[model samples]
Target: MYRGRLAYRPRSETANKIREVNKMKEGIHPNYYQAKVVCNCGNEFVTGSTKKDIHVEVCSKCHSFYTGQQKAAAARGRIDKFNRKYGIQ
Candidate 1:
């Protein structure tokens, strides 16, 4: 027994004709402009987006995963309680 190779399915003539008739009208879609991303660590880069500008808290420059510096983020009250209960230094 031999397995048959997969074949490409050509588009139907009616589908092609319908696509030609139903062409998209221009000037209706939203404008896509360049957006600037600013990170807290002073990293900035330009990218394409629907919005004109974007602000972010973290980026490749300051992210712990990228920088290899992990800092524990704990609330003030939670840190105090945990330290007091566990007597952690």
Candidate 2:
């Protein structure tokens, strides 16, 4: 739940049946097709070896706050949830 609302609830089988009237979609992205990824920082490089540009929004050298941004966000969210649950805030 989030802000007094369900974040993820299973959809009913009937809900799945309803389809969009306009069923149009694009193909795979061309950039993703490329085997190599060059970070804007020009400090690091990633290839198919590392499971494709992942776990990072930007390279460490380019981003103002690198390495712990994702971790910090998650920590803050968890702390907020705990506070709400225990009236600690």
Top candidate when judged by lDDT against the true structure: 1
Per-residue CA lDDT of model 2 for 15-88, tens digit only, reads 66665533556664333432355665555555564245444446656664666577788889999999999999
Question: Which consecutive 10 residues in model 2 have the weakest lDDT in total?
Answer: 28-37
Off by over 4 Å in 1: 1-13, 21-28, 71-89
1-89: candidate 1 lDDT, tens digit per residue: 76988889999999999999899878998889999998888889999998998999999998877776563443556788999999997
* lDDT for predicted candidate 1 compared with the true structure: 0.86
lDDT of 2 at 49: 44
Tell me, by TM-score, which candidate is best: 1
State each model's CA lDDT, in order. 0.86, 0.63
Candidate 1 worst ten-residue window by lDDT: 68-77
Query: What's each prediction's clash count?
Result: 0, 0
